[model samples]
Target chain A: MRTIRVELGERSYPIHIGSGLLKNIGAYCQEAGFALRSPLLVVSDSTVAPLYLPQVEEALRSQGYQVVTHIFPAGEASKSLAVYEDVMTTAIQGGLDRHSAILALGGGVVGDLAGYVAATYMRGIGFMQIPTTILAHDSSVGGKVAVNHPLAKNMIGAFYQPAMVVYDLDTLLTLPPRQVSSGLAEAIKHGLITDEVFAYWCREHAEELLALDLEALGYALELGCSIKAKVVGNDERENGLRAVLNLGHTIGHAIEAVGGYGVFLHGEAIAIGMAGSALLAAKLGRDRAIYEETVSMLTALSLPIRLPEQYSEDDLMEAMKHDKKFKEGKMTFIIPEAIGSVSIVNDIDEQLVREVLAQLKKEDNPW
Target chain B: MRTIRVELGERSYPIHIGSGLLKNIGAYCQEAGFALRSPLLVVSDSTVAPLYLPQVEEALRSQGYQVVTHIFPAGEASKSLAVYEDVMTTAIQGGLDRHSAILALGGGVVGDLAGYVAATYMRGIGFMQIPTTILAHDSSVGGKVAVNHPLAKNMIGAFYQPAMVVYDLDTLLTLPPRQVSSGLAEAIKHGLITDEVFAYWCREHAEELLALDLEALGYALELGCSIKAKVVGNDERENGLRAVLNLGHTIGHAIEAVGGYGVFLHGEAIAIGMAGSALLAAKLGRDRAIYEETVSMLTALSLPIRLPEQYSEDDLMEAMKHDKKFKEGKMTFIIPEAIGSVSIVNDIDEQLVREVLAQLKKEDNPW
Candidate 1:
């Protein structure tokens, strides 16, 4: 078992990663200082619940902790206020107290939604992130829990940290190939943003990671979580330094929004955005090698580096304008200076972004 | 103007109280360091909007702030998730950026609804409290912002502090006599729990406060805000010391719920709960003068000290069971030790609370 602590002072908590940890969830809860007297609410999505909910409940109940379960349909659409309200209703009906904790038992969507439920329920309660998917390696580590609004993704949320994060790697054995690639995109992002060696390591071990090699996958997740935890700990509210973590997010969110959040997974969209950022860096007269290397890394993991031809540049630009990163009619892009390094550049030219989008949409590789 | 600062380390902010302060709101915004580049959203209810929103918008506009206004229907019913979502829609549609500020421009309902919006919008933006009612003196300063759920009041909310609180004494002139009494309930509560002298002063100057004498009201509000700010500063998340701020909230919230939150205003219900707390303290072997003095103070301000006969004791107890303060099937009551001191007592006998309720509902004065 490997444990990484997110150093947020009083709000600090640990992320425990290992095999078959779900069966010992009760012991984890006890070690994490969760009281048995208070009832616990386990929020899961339909896909993850059928597989793991019974084991989680049995473990908690065996430890004399009252357990209540709330399962919503599995998808990005479930990350809405209406679904958040449903989970809140279950929490209220379940008689969960202020001390009671809400455990997220699925992937990124479930983690985001349940973390948000904990953030606002009774003006913030105890929350534990139990990430089941590889993509959640990014979402669950940071305290940025939110439900998407009709107008935009993650428009409504809070920076409420969790009590702990229990990552049971055994759950990842069930993920399909597409989801696995999607999840690894963020793991690769961690390396692309700060760790040069890890970036090359991820690309080198792409097959092992994709083939569900436990040792390789475990090492990647731990490194990714550590990089994310360091960034989040320094700037919890994204005042300045934290913006670097959004290297691909500015353009990435736009891609996700333009694709209606369904056509592409969040990690897939971000992978393309990272590719776009590298291209944008080259357009701004940075080294062209940045673009080549980013695309190479993403492609090695079977992640797409091109936008679907159907999405128009104008629509993508419109979506970027609605993003939280867009300010005063100016786009803020986390432009890559080189591999494992980035700089936050404000007021990037719209025409340059459009040019990059056009190039990305080409049927052939621009490189 | 009188300023009392809530010392919350980096989150600390000032409460500005005086006559005609709204006319100079633009100056306050500038002094508090609100940026002119980002647009500002003002959230008001129909009633307060008609009275002050125009002047506020004009003031902000004069200071080069691009202002947008969102007004919902007036009253407690407006503080629901639906209205909260409506305000969020208006905020998004208004093109509010991360740096933009949200000004809560009404009483507690508007402040709570708007503050919750700010707390969650783009993972929180800048928020300022512009209070237009005497009741807001209590609500605005403490940063306890929330909207009610169908199942409960303040069930969904956050302890998000505002940039500053602007209390314009002129707005209090428009309040009706019943509102004057309702608002004073909290002011008297602040004094009762912390300062014996202030509590007696509130009783002594009841007529001046009700008559809208700006001098007396100003002094009273400053004192009340200071008391609250001190308590809130010491304990921001209600881990321990802050629970005393709920002097009458346990019983007060129960009464409000049983009455469907419409029959009595929040302060009025709390007034009766204060009376009930005094009775409970007496039953627990405290001085009988505590009950008499409390009833005398409430009556002096035209606040009710008795629950209406329509509410059954059983119904009130059931409501208490659902309160956030109720834990492990035990009631946590802020019991008065004397006229100006209180203590948080947990696991109080339910039957004893029932007796207090029965006594409070009687036609005759139990004291």
Candidate 2:
């Protein structure tokens, strides 16, 4: 098993990446100072619970853990306050204690919502992540768990770290093809911000990865998680260099909000967002080829490059104002200086944004 | 103004304590980089809204802030998830943004509930505290903001820090006698844990304080807030040393929980809780005299030493299980080692708690 430590001092935890990691989660909890006999709360969604919840529960129970599972419907809708209330009530009824760690066994939706529940439940309980989809490889390790508010996505959440995140590669075998491509958006972000070699690797292995090449996929997952762990350790609250991780997220979140949260997958929205940001970068005097290259790479992965129907430039601008990055009533965008470089720019001209949005709007094709 | 910094690195904020400080809040926000022209969302309760919200709004408006006020019914009952939802929706309608700072202008109930709203609104927005009651002297300083769940108090909340805390002593002049005494419980606790001089002062001015003696009360308020500031700075997440501040709160919370939250003022419940903890300490052979002294001092201040006749010891124990301090189903107690000394003791004997409860059962004539 390969391990990457997210160094957040007392809040720090490890992400174990490999096959068979799920079967040994109880031992990890034991080593993390949790009681082996303590009850484990397995939190998941309707989509993933049926496939992995039983195996995760069995894995813990085999090592003497008394497991109780709670499943919510999968989608952005499940990240509401009502759902948070229900999940918390269930946790209390199941007799979860500090020693009774929460095992989040699902994709990004379940990971974000359940991680938030664990963070606030009893002022936080121990939690371990058994990421089932490729999308979770980034989210599970970063500790940025949140539920979406009506006006915004991830508008209600905390920067809470998990005790351990077990990213079992074997679990990804069951992830849908579209989900894998969606996740590549984040992996692409890590490459664009810090690692050029990883960017080239992604460029080379796009097809192999889409074909479910296990070794290539495992390397990509570990690399993404390791980079995330380092960034989170250095800047957990995303104040400084950590904001670099939000390369495409600013415009991406606006897309998600404008389209309404559940209309597009998180990574799918980000794919188009990256395109918009890249276009903005080219307009701001960054290399034109880098923008074209980014679009081509995303398109080759079969990720959507078109903005959603019914979303206008004005709607995107309005949605961007709601972003946490907005300060002094002006939206900030993270634009690339080049393919392997980016910066958080707050002084971008609004007219420039309008021009880029106008270009994105005038595209002939929807996808 | 005397400033106390609750230093949690980047999340650190100033606690400005002095008389007439509310008038300068606009200046402080501007200097802190927040635009004073943005609409201010003032969240308070009905009891405090009529009393202080006008002055607060007047001060902000005079400085060109577009102030919008929201008032919920004043009481512990208002600290529900329903109330929080209402506040969030109102904030959305009022155009509150990441730039807009929420001024929580009331006692503990307002501070806890509003702070939780600020913590989750748009995934966290900047908020300030204009504590109008003595009980707020404690709630406003620590970043531990939360609302009570049906089965538990503070079960649903997060450790969200504020931009600044404005403790204007003039606001405390209109505070009721019961609120004054409630605030004193924490003042007494600070003395018990770290400041012996404050403890002695509590004993000396018990009568004056109960009568709202401004000089004595202000001194006590400053001392308590300063001590809490020091502890919170050192342990933002309550990992170790910060638990000292919760002296008597573990059992005090249980008592309040069993009594249905609003029946007993928080300070009244804590006063009795201190008596119970002192008795427990005496039984444990740490400092019997200190326990007796605390009980005597509480009696002198006219604080209740008995739990409400309705709640049985079993009900208190059941409520204690929901406390955040419960690790693996075992409730931990913050017991005194001696006067001016405290420690978290996990191995408290249940029979001893029953004995303490039995003492409350006795219908006594006079001390």
Best by TM-score: 1
Candidate chain B TM-scores, in order: 0.98, 0.95
Predicted complex 2: CAPRI docking category? medium
DockQ of 2: 0.53
User: For candidate 2, what TM-score does chain B get against the true chain B?
Assistant: 0.95
> What C-alpha lDDT do the candidate models reach, one value each?
0.91, 0.81
Instruction: Calculate DockQ per candidate and list them.
Output: 0.80, 0.53
How much is the lDDT of residue B59 in candidate 2?
78
Most lDDT-accurate candidate:
1
* Residue clash pairs of candidate 1: none
State the DockQ, from 0 to 1, for candidate 1: 0.80
lDDT of each residue in B1-367, candidate 2, tens digit only: 6777777888888877778887777786675556675677889999988987777788788878888788999999888888988888787667776667788989989999889988877666778888888878888998888987888888888888888888888888887777777888878878888877778889998888877777887788888888898999888878789988878787788887887787778888888888888877877886567867887778777778876667788988777777777766566788888778888888666677777776765556212
